[model samples]
Target: MSAPPLLVHLDGGVMTLTLNRPHKLNAIDNPLAQALSEALSSAAADAAVRAVLVLGAGRAFCAGRDVSAPPTDRDLELVQAVSRQIVMLDKPVVFAVHGWTVGAGFEWMLDADVALASADARFKLPEASLGVFVTGGLTATLTASAGLARAKATMLLGEAFGADEAQAWGLLWRVVPPDALEATAREAAQRLALLKPEVAARFKRVLNEVGLARFDRAIALENAAQQALQTGG
Candidate 1:
């Protein structure tokens, strides 16, 4: 079988993190999430990597968390931790989504400086259908992206949207054909790598504070909920 997904490749000034579990549609379990967090943190700590690119190994980017794994608060923790890291990273992060991005996996995109997706890629947020609140800060980011009405529809309907619809709704930065996704996004990442990492970092900071003000509040709320569950509250 192909090596387990989650490959971290470092080049001249860019770090590419590939979600390798294509067989499982790159599901994010605790270990995978932790690995992603560690990899992202490592990239941020390294001075040579000015920009980072995240892509899936095979067809899908991420099919959300693997529910078959024993459920635990750790699943949510892993995603939130990595998301916080992405939001706080000193370097730029560009998410290149190829196939599916559902539930928690969709929230990961919200943390990126820019998100590019293949035209064949799909998106959805189905937490409500599953009877759980989102822990990846999608509760807040969705409102910013699709407005309260569209966001509510997503939660209630839990249906998938194609790349065109996603881009039109401001949920994606750019969309191209599946074959062109990596090349297109990597080109953008390469350009970003040429800039001062601090510039992208500062832009990310200010954008969160100004444009995405509610993100901080959402994460705080999520953390409290997680802690309460941890304490059996």
Candidate 2:
């Protein structure tokens, strides 16, 4: 039997979600999307899960959607659900991104409470150039993180950027050497898990309330635009 596309592991109050499609560089397909959505739900419901750690198996974090399969409205909805779930979850979410983090991968990284990238990490938002629109509340998060001009350039041009540039743009919490990336990320997540659950949850909630005020509106607009593009409207 093939391994599941998404791996879930819980330890020491930290729920680790690993993208398991290494052969395809953890590209998102419907199956992977579905699995991720379900896993996020599990994390949300599990009181034992105090913090979440997201990692990519093998070489890359994610190379975005599986182009071979194409995307549908279901895919868009699932991506939105995953994004919303991450934000709504009371626990801190940490992302350890490496290799190519493109399209939705880039957007999800923006959603993290803390995102750490490896020296070899590369990021891009290629949806506009590919004739599709971005999912996730990227319009809000990307613009807020990197500013309007840089976000526009990244989405329109689809250019790949390295970790240092991403950090400079305020997209990454920290940039570590490739060899230390995983360990460093784990430590961060564990530290977050160690915080008092009620206090930590309240802290995150207040932060999101202030920073992600436009997230829902952005998702709605992106969904409408993507639907129009797909339907030739």
Candidate 3:
């Protein structure tokens, strides 16, 4: 049998969710998408999991959708669901990204509470070039974090950028050497785990309320666009 797509481990108060399909650079296939959504849901429900850390195994973080095959409707829905779970989960969600982070994977990082990247990490938003709309409320989050002009250029061009560029664009909390990324991210997650659960929840709730006021609406609009494109509307 093949290995599972997601590996979940709880250490201290940090729940580490590792994307295990390294052969495809942790690309989001249907099974991987379902696994990620279920894992995040479990993290939200489990009291022992004070903070959640997402990592990718092997060479890269995530290469976005597994394009070897077209995404099914269920895959699309799960992708959006997982994005909501990451953003809406009361607990702190941290992402440590390296290698290629593209398409939906890039959006997942934006949905995260905090994201750290290795110096060699690369990012791209290829949805526009690929003729698909983005999920994970990226339309709102990217514009809010990177400003309207930068966000439009980044999405419209669908060009790849380095970690330093991503950090400069206000996407990453920090960019460390490739070897130091995991440790740096763990430290951040541990610090977040120290916060009182109720306070952390409330902090995230209020901050998101103000910072991501358009998140839900953006998601709805993107979903409609995606459906239209899929149905040739």
Give the CA lDDT, 0 to 100, for residue 183 in model 1.
94
Candidate 1 backbone collisions, by pair: 5-20, 6-20
Which scores better on lDDT, 2 or 3? 3
Residue 208 lDDT in model 1? 77
Against the hidden reference, what TM-scores do the models get?
A: 0.92, 0.98, 0.98
Kindly list the per-residue Cα lDDT of model 3 for residues 178-217, writing each as its tens digit: 9999999999999999999999999999999999999999
* Candidate 1: tens digits of C-alpha lDDT, residues 52-78: 999988778899888785447677678
- Of 1 and 3, which scores higher on TM-score? 3
Better of 1 and 2 by TM-score: 2
Superposed model 1: Cα runs more than 4 Å off: 223-233
- Per-residue lDDT of 1-233 in model 2, one digit per residue for the tens? 99999999999999999999999999988888899889888888988998999999999999998899667999899888888888888989999999999888878888889999999999888888789999889999989888999988988888889999999999889999999998999999999999999998999999988988999999999999999999999
lDDT of each: 0.83, 0.91, 0.93
Which sequence of candidate numbers ranks them by lDDT, best first? 3, 2, 1
